[model samples]
Target: MSPFDQHQPAAKPLTVLIVAYLFPPLAGGGIPRVQKLVKYLNRMGVHTIVLTVEPPPGMVEDPTLLNDIPAHTPISRVPLPRWMNAFLGLWRRRSESESGKQDGTHSVDAKLHETAQEHGQARSLNMKQGQTDQRNTVFRKGPQKLKQSVQKIVGHALNWLRARIFVPDDEVVWVRGAVRAGMRVIERYPVDLIFSSSGPLSNHLVARSLKRKTHLPWVADFRDPWTENMHRTSIRWRLALEKRMEKSVFEEADAITTVTESFAQDFKRLYPARDVHVIYNGFDPEDFMELEGSPPNAPLTFAYTGILYGKRHPRYFFQALKRLIDDGMIRPDDVRLEVAGVLDYPGRSENRDALIALGLETVVRDHGFLPHREALALLKTSHVLVVFGDQEATAGRYIPGKLFEYMAIGRPILGLLKPGEASRIIEQFALGVHADPSDVDEIEEALRHIVTLYRSGALLKDIAHCSSKDRLSANERLCANERLSADERFTSEACLALEDRLRRFRRDVQAEAFYALFQSVVGAKQR
Candidate 1:
């Protein structure tokens, strides 16, 4: 039997307390990993009791995800104090309004920036705009300056307070309540192990407290890295403090699990004695069983679902799409791009205007913040699915959770990624086309290849046959002839082998890995 096969326990099932702040009905990138683990671990003779925070207002919510939890599983949801919730609600609304205004202005600024860069007129425009602003503000200066001074002082004080008070993360406030709730759950249930998944990092903090109190064999899971995370705070003192906290938590946990091998390696390097395992984020195959219909029809739709924030913006992808339309290689109406999920990040509004400025508003559809199931259905109906890596050098370390679902959807993938774990996965599986996200020209070429293969009715056939070398060498000049001969395609036997390889990433397989780790950790403690 495969190592991933679930082992049936002869004795009573192990019961684990799963501490995850980002569990459903909170919709996010972090939800699928924890939710799927809960779903499959329960089926594998492990009872899971979830410990999560009550959903805050204005956060994305999907009640549909709750259905994935096994019936009668215990869940303890710790809530914030009423005053704290009210303060957060008001703060969130204000932030939303400010971000909205910033997005609008960002679009306008981007247009100007683009125009200036092309025409070498940036200095001239800046000078002109500055002069106009000075002239306009001269008569209204005294009160404005006073207001600005007061606001700047308050902002500085708030930033200082946030830096100190929100150590590790803002979710630290929930730690006390969650720890109390967890203690109650342990008292009520026959909890055998403690598991926590991090993003807020407070989940681990809560588990750390419980581990101290009860001395349970604790497993801390990092969905993303801690101090080394790409989005981590840049403040020197804060970074130092976070590094210390991260070390302390990892040192206390009996086993540590992360979503990527790269992350696991990093953790091992930092704490060579710690037991670290890679439990990949994966798709529920059952979710895709019903989407196995015929390929989507024309207009050559390319869909991207999930939040577009941070450096994970689609500017390069949009630019590539625009270029294809401008060159008439792709007709405006015959091709479309569908974007789902929150697009409220900085420069994203500007990117939308970039689409319009480049005459592609009609070519790209924006479906903001779709329900998870609806997003999957839309992806199934699209000809191509796109995932953008962060433009930063560290982009390769992250394999977006959505990529696995795209793989299961079995469509031609347009991976605008760097040379990292994610790109290697696509190439290793012969999944689809990938390009350097930073390279507009390369992205355009990759998109061209996808479109060509789709039109020739050879996309799937070509994807299955082409090796990573073949794909990298394929250029615009060679796209049409890139399809290999009939003998070049994998045989039916070989195809089954390839499918077997992909099974390692199935949710059930991943959950089995988790169960094995849990058994070992618990057994080691007993010994």
Candidate 2:
């Protein structure tokens, strides 16, 4: 028997420790992927222990989302010091401003003046050299040899204070807390593996620390690239250090998994000797239940969910729709574009003005942010799902988690991205249409094609028959397996049936031919 046949059932479940900074009640793109993974892992006989933060304020709590996890799944919640997080944000902003000024307007003389003022104030206040300067004296000297020397000393001192006050335990603080809590859990229970998911990328730090102490095999899951993530733009000096840190994580990990094949390739390229796995995010089959019975609705509602920030602009889609409206190709009242997600950065104003400028204000409806299930429900109601990708370096390398859920909806997709990984996946699945965002004409053509198909009542049939290759391949495999099984059964049941019949026929034929030849030979001899 084959090994697979002998092992009809799986072995004892794997114990997984998931370290993530963002978990439910945190509303973001990463949450769904993490939640689904844990839920599905449990379903597949994996015991999951989640270590995450208590959901930040202003986020909703949904215990039902945790239902997929086994009843006994361990959950560790670490409290983040809100004040420290806030201070870090403030300090980062100030540092950026200071760095920019140092490169631009601030002269060496002015910088010296600033430093002197700070130093005198520290002395007058009887404060230590590294003590507080109510003036927030981060950038006081320009980039000169002597000035840099003074700055380094003062900066180190300030960093010490900041670390003590803001991040008292450094980057591993959260991990240390989780480990302390997790150690107790481990002592009472068993953990087979440590799985860490990252974006705050800090989770890896925690996992790394835990692995050092526990010596457990660790899997680091990266939802996006670390350090080289397109969204991140650090100062030049910090870039090298950040790259080194990212490399350390990649090296120390026993197994690394990413969401997209392209990213897996990139990860492998960075660490040439490492084995990286590509596990594309998948959707729960239940998300498509609504689509099974529903017919396409009129007016063709289009929906886009998730944050559309940085270079992942929606300008192309808006422009094409605007042109269609302007050219009378599609009536304004005949279509509605619904965007459901947080717009702009947190605590910032909305992008209503930008949308208005693009002439999409009236046609586009902003649903803001909604719960995951609610968003999936909304997806079912739409005729098409819009998948937008940035044109930047990270464009096609990372497939958004939403693509999977969108696929699950089984609705036709409208992909506006550069011709790359995302487009390839969409084509491979026969999911939807793709257009180059750079070409308005192509975008218009694709949009019009959908409109024409809808009008002609051929859209549904076209989607059904568009991809038979995958189905045909599956059928061929099944046929081959059936033939192999039949052959095995025939050999076991009646192995000599054909051979016995053939042997009897041959003997009868040979005897008849020999007798005829003997008579012929005698007749010839007499003649």
Most accurate candidate by lDDT: 1
lDDT of 2: 0.56
Off by over 4 Å in 2: 1-13, 59-63, 85-173, 290-297, 344-351, 462-527
After superposing all C-alphas onto the true structure, candidate 2 shows an RMSD in angstroms of 22.2
Q: Residues 1-527, candidate 2: write the lDDT tens digits.
A: 32222322236545667787667645456665567666655554556788887654333344445655567777888875676445434433223212212221111100111111212222212422223333222212224566545544554454445433321112344566777766666666677667777665667878887788887777788877765565543345445555776788888777777777778888888899988765555555443333333334556678888655435656667678778788887776677666666333222222444556755555555555555666676676677788877667456676766776676555688888777877886775466789876667888889998878766775554222112343322112111111123345434223233223222112122222222322232234336
- lDDT of every model, 2 decimals: 0.69, 0.56
lDDT of 1 by residue, 351-440 (tens): 565665676656655555555777787787777789877777876888888888887766767888888899998877666889998899
Total clashing residue pairs per candidate? 1, 0
lDDT score of residue 224 within candidate 1: 81
Cand. 2 TM to true fold:
0.68
Leading candidate by TM-score = 1
- Candidate 2 residue pairs in backbone clash: none
